[model samples]
Target: MILKIGKLFIAAVIFTGISALAVSAFAASGPALFRSEGCIACHTIDGHGGSVGPNLSHIGSQRSLSWIKTQIVTPGAHFASGSTVTINGKSYMAIMPNHKNMPASDVNTIAQYLESLK
Candidate 1:
């Protein structure tokens, strides 16, 4: 019984260490992914980027994390594709591509990063 308990404790410790590493990686990758994933091409943050999509400088202040995730994975859920949507007094076409095939980890990381903007 003591040996089993010891093994279980060791297993738990390893799992915790791995989990911490994963969380750290997730937290660190968001900004990089945002840039590498071509988000900068259409969204502006901190006064940099293109004008194709709505500026995301204060997206976190305006949107929830879950909402951002949904927008990333399935933007059509919020707005019909090819339709015009108004945001912050500006008109924009709902042209953001759907990322349904993107890895969930990337989506979560991006959402968390955007949610932390505020």
Candidate 2:
């Protein structure tokens, strides 16, 4: 009976270790991909980053994968039209560069990573 219990414990430990390794690999990839894509320049996450774009500290919780994917693929479409900022008492059109041309797969990866942030 003890031998059977020992075997079960060993299996559980091995499973846990494998799961940990997988999570570590995923975590590493997310940040690495984020840097490679230049997202760090415009967005602040976890209370650190630039101020040019909206805070993404909890974007994962707010946006679904499909919504996130669309934003990445067509950045301009997701944002509201027309510039709300006033310059010289005149409304200036908000300018957000389009990312529609970026590869869908890469954007999907980014979206997945962002969704997992929380």
RMSD of each: 2.9, 6.9
Global lDDT of each candidate:
0.92, 0.72
| Top candidate (lDDT) | 1
> Candidate 1 has what TM-score?
0.78
> In candidate 2, how many Å is residue 106 off?
1.0
Tens digit of per-residue lDDT, candidate 1, span 1-118: 9999999999999999999999886654877989988999999989989998988988999999999999999999999999999999999999999999988988998999999997
RMSD in angstroms between candidate 2 and the native structure over all alpha carbons:
6.9
lDDT of 2 by residue, 1-118 (tens): 9999999999999999999999777653656666777777777788767655666777788789998887776665665655565423445354545677766767777888889876
Worst 10 residues of 1 by lDDT: 23-32
**Lowest-lDDT window of 10 residues in candidate 2?**
85-94
On a 0 to 1 TM-score scale, where does candidate 2 land against the true structure? Answer: 0.60
